[model samples]
Target chain A: MSDFQFDKIALIGIGLIGSSIARAIKLHGLAREISISTRSPLTLARAEELELGTFYTESAAECVKDADLVIVSVPVGASGAVAEQIAPALKQGAILTDVGSTKASVISQMQPFVPEGVHFIPGHPVAGTEHSGPDAGFADLFEGRWCILTPVEDTDAEAVRKLRSFWESLGSRVDEMDAEHHDKVLAIVSHLPHIIAYNIVGTAEDLETVTESEVIKYSASGFRDFTRLAASDPVMWRDVCLHNKDAILEMLARFSEDLAYLQRAIRWGEGDKLFDLFTRTRAVRRSIIEAGQDIAEADFGRHIRHEK
Target chain B: MSDFQFDKIALIGIGLIGSSIARAIKLHGLAREISISTRSPLTLARAEELELGTFYTESAAECVKDADLVIVSVPVGASGAVAEQIAPALKQGAILTDVGSTKASVISQMQPFVPEGVHFIPGHPVAGTEHSGPDAGFADLFEGRWCILTPVEDTDAEAVRKLRSFWESLGSRVDEMDAEHHDKVLAIVSHLPHIIAYNIVGTAEDLETVTESEVIKYSASGFRDFTRLAASDPVMWRDVCLHNKDAILEMLARFSEDLAYLQRAIRWGEGDKLFDLFTRTRAVRRSIIEAGQDIAEADFGRHIRHEK
Candidate 1:
């Protein structure tokens, strides 16, 4: 049997995730034809130059014409705009999905415009790097990563299965959950971590007592790790903060409360309290490694020091 | 001229930093012999199994006997205890230094115990990995890293010069700073980041809305980055928090205050404010890369997503 799943796969917003999807589709021969589109003419041209897809267009509507699968891979903030532009062009019975970070917001924004016959399955592939753009993507970006799907109750079961298989072919472990739960879980795991990293880097930058040079010079001590996350695409993260406002706010509130307790312990020189919390947190990392969510390599296997 | 700077070097702790120093000393032929000691008999045995030094002992005093250079590499909290144990045995005119993260407190703890002729200098190598123990040590742990020395005003200048040369031979760029300044600088750069990472990981683990499995499954989004730092040795970090309480508390106050401001910005839906802060922090990462404090590789150059 042929491995081809979709006759035509249209990818809107050819950034990191979108380009990676295109590459994976090509690598796996999952789609017979791939069409790519983005709002920016330069990005579209770049995508074309990179030969990421079989067809390239500046119009989302033109890109999605006759497509069996339309994947909206844009920032969460741009979801509604892309949806409206492509909704009329979406083929009947086509599966429409997204690879946004915020599932609930993206669902809300796109569900209104999605045609009645189209299967609108909102998803978030919990995989990325700080770098974005077509050049930063690789075919294996989603491999060994989890891709979550939050389909509405009335969505066709067969459509959901097909979509799950599509992601599986791309080497993602697919799981289904309600949109609300996905948002809440992601708010804690993804959104809040990025916000905290961005906030801490900003805090270090604005310090009057510590110069930027000093902060950068000594960053490898610990601060450099935060900077890696803080250096992520600002627009995508900004959209994540704006779209997933309530869930992120809730997580932030909890994080701050915990931080306040830690601060009080530090102030009082409560060594036992500090040590207990520190010891408890270490187990989380071990669990992540055991679950295969992270590599067991030392220092992320950076080869930081030269061999003697 | 022969590069052998010391006839005998004693390492008063056999953990990561201490063993790394032993390896570096041997790699560079900087010392004729190395005596390794730790409070724990098991750790001493492990150090001996690794053949980290020419001699190994459980007695800190015995380790320091007849040593021309003595490096106390215990946690900051244990500095005073180790100092008192080895003080009477320290050779006259020997250079006594430490690799504690904190400076002012370490100096205060060890300075009074120093003999009349021993040159007491407190130093910190702004380098480490999340892993601990003697096996985690490598010869190049200090390569291309900074080692800050905070010598007392009345300390011998020749002793300081020899110590500088010693670290230079270990491949570290050495800088001199006052103990107070070193404490403050490290407070913002090192201590606060670790504390914040620990606090955030703990908060995530305690969340009622998100399951631990969900957090681990979706960690690649951003949470995994913090876990790397949070996975660090708990005892060392607890000691850091306790020894640098004043500086760490001050930095924590600043960090919490700044985080509060960010919290307000997100709660108020201030996208522009969020974008500006995110954009500004990106520059710091670039500066760190340019300063060679961090690798310019993407995604921390993790071979993550491979080996499936």
Candidate 2:
């Protein structure tokens, strides 16, 4: 059997994820024709400059006309607006999907606008760098990563399978889960970490005693690791916070409670308590390395080659 | 003038820092001979197997006897114990220094036991990995990294300069700060981050809703970055928490306050507030990269070569 191929693929919001999908499709020859669209004229021009697609347009509706697949790669907060704009132009029986970090909110926002025959499968490819825009993307962004598809009940089974296969062809390991579960899982893993990183960096920046230069100079000591996540695209993260408020707030509550316990342990000079907690957390990192989710080298394998 | 060279060097506690110092000394030919000592016989044996130093001993006193320089690279909690054990055996006019994370506690712990003529300068080389022990050290570990020295008020200026040069020969950029300031700076830059990482990982592991395997699988989303710091040596971090209690507690307070503000913003769906904070923090990462404290590549420059 031949691999899945869409007659025309419409990619809305040609930012990092959109541009990456464009590159991956081109590299794999997964689409007969690709159309790129973004509201910003500057971004659309950049996408054209990068040759990310055969057809480029500033209109989302124009980009989706006659397209067999529509991948909405915009921020979560923009999902409703994008879906509303493209609804009239969506082709019948087309597989419509998204690459938003939050699933439940995106599903609710886009579901009303998705045409009757069009399949709306919410997805989150659990991969990214702290970079955004067309130049920040590459074809192999999804390689060795998990792409989660959260299809709502009563959706077409054939559409789900086709979407899964398409992602697999792009080098992603595809998995299916409920939208609510996906949101909860991501709340703890992705959203909470980013928030903590931003908050810590902000804390460091606001300190009167510790100068910004000192924070930068001594950052390699540990603080620099958090800065990478803190440096992520603000708009996407802001939409994530607005869209997945409940789950994120729950995770934040748990995180703060745990941090309070740790602070108390330090205040009371409870060395054993601190030691046990620290030791327990180390095993998780080992498991991540063993599972091939992270590099096995120490210090993320940076600057190790020069060691004598 | 030639750089300062020791006729014999004693490395008390053959862990990551000690072994790295041993290798740097050998690589740069800064010492004629190196004696290694550790409380753990197993670590001492491993140091011998690695040939980290010329002489291996279980006795700190024996290791320091007649040595021109003695470096105590133990947990901050053990500073006083090591100092008391090796005081009488320290050679006259020999420079005694440490590579502990905290300076004020180390200085307070080791100062009373210092002999009249021996120059004791408390130092913290702000470079390390999540790994520890003799096998984890490398000769170039200190290259382009900062080593902060907190010398006492009455300490000999010549001895401080000599110790500073010794660290510089090991490929460090050395700076001098008061003990209290060093403790405060490190508490924010290093200790708090590790503690926060440990706490968040602990919280995730303890969550009833999220399976451990799920966390291991989806770590790349963001949580994995914190795990690197969280996976650090339990004993070493526990010692840091106890020895630098006041400064660490202060930083924790500031961190928690900032996190609370962020949490409230998320709860209220304040996109602008979230966006503003996230945007502000990105500059610090840029500053760190500009300072050469961290690599400019995304994701700490790990596994990017395979991306197309």
Candidate 3:
């Protein structure tokens, strides 16, 4: 706690990501004072009850006043509105960042409102469980997870360094990239997977041949895996799909194309092709486990943490 | 143990499913003698090491001699060959059943080889983890799970009743359904999910734009959930796809149609549509949790049991 960096950090939209960052900051004593704001009075009162911050307000502008760092953790679609609300009260020379999943949209939504003195850096911590809301947060949610910071060109190097240090103090590994590249990378890795999960689960629900109860009953065989992801925050995912449309659609197209080919192989009794694909995909799981991105400690750690 | 039924039980494939049944049967004293056979000498030796049965034989025919009950647990594609190999040695009036995922194909493949006196019933235990091999077997694997029995016309009722008792002893709820219906139900529930998982994981691997390491590093977002199912037994899943082609194709066709609709919604920025679909799917997960099919008890139980 001796190296506590920021005098104050303002968290706008204290939901899952905001609350998680609050937990991490408090656990590491990264900030002397934490101010929180949300659009809903109910959520604001809830945050106060949880004591997630030194001060709670419904005004984003009030929350950002005199803060050394301002983190906007709203849905991507609300980025512009949050920026507009906070721009008036942002401290000169303060680091203003966001933890939205889609970076390009966040930059576009936020960069225009940035005053000359404030560093407008867009970031996304590539970490979270399917659960949402303040109670879903935990101190170590970002531990060993990648926090991608997408700083636009000509952004202050000092501001980037401070932001990196802030994330590092919260147990995240920070890396920098352009906003567009980050969106494209995330489109395939995160957005597409969620979309696919939602789609498949939707498909199963719409099935007339097989009842939904049967799908639920035998889901442990395979379909249940998708249910966990499909149960993600709907509003957040909706915003992500709309904001990262181009990159997500591109990935979705490729995914659909590959799926069609696999479907044909199954229809044509091409056992060899199916075997090859199934065998090849097994290696990716091994790689994920080896990378320490997955909980190599056990097979079901991901789900267990979600339950907790 | 006085209620034990079978005089002699022969297991023709001592892998995960077979070995599990062997342990359950032995623990419950379900049979006077248990004979295990495997084509692979290594597996036979390992099964012997596990003390899975009272006697072990390299020949399926030699193992089934004088057996009143025969349970074949093999890859669906190998069902015909195994049936032909052991058909002559099957004792008169024996109840011959299988634990194949695909019932229609197994019944089609094995029925002709089964002698007139044998009660050839096709059964599927709707339970198993992704893990495979004899070493992965556990006695309680079948607890509180469903097992569907698809009996052919003129199949002996007494034999069906006896098989139900056997599965009940192993702690599975047994149900009767026709072979085609079983295939369709399983296609939507199990097969299609595995196919989609394998396909999406394969698509991720083939992307040059997003490195495999990046996908794995950030997989916790949702992609890692798919990887577990994708890492399942390739040979077993391949046999399933090959054996149950029509039903899987039907499910795949429905799946693609629904995906295209969702893709269009995403392309057209239909947030309400996406939100509605996402919300509807969450109920299925709730139903699953309510049904006790996936309540995270297994992992915690395993943790406690292993600690002890």
Name the top DockQ candidate.
1
User: Clashes in model 2: which pairs?
Assistant: none
lDDT for position B249 in model 1: 83
In order, how many clashes per candidate?
0, 0, 0
* Per-residue accuracy of model 2 over B1-308 as CA lDDT, tens digit each: 44539889999998888999999999999988899999999999999999998999999999999998999999899999999999999999999999999988888889999999999988999999999999999999999999999999898999998898899998899999999999999999999999989998999999888888888878889999999999999999999999999999999999988888888888877778999999999999988888888787767766573322
lDDT (CA) per prediction: 0.89, 0.91, 0.86
- Order the candidate numbers by lDDT, best to worst: 2, 1, 3
What's the true lDDT of residue B70 in model 3?
Answer: 96
Candidate 2 steric clashes: 0
lDDT winner between candidates 1 and 3: 1
Model 3 DockQ (Cα-based):
0.54
Candidate closer to the true structure by lDDT (higher is better), 1 or 2: 2
Looking only at chain B, model 2 earns a TM-score of: 0.97
Q: Rank the candidates by DockQ, best first.
A: 1, 2, 3
lDDT of 1 by residue, B76-151 (tens): 9899999999999999999999999998889889888998999998899999999899999888888888999998
| TM-scores for every predicted model | 0.98, 0.98, 0.95
Q: Candidate 2, overall lDDT?
A: 0.91
| Candidate with maximal lDDT | 2
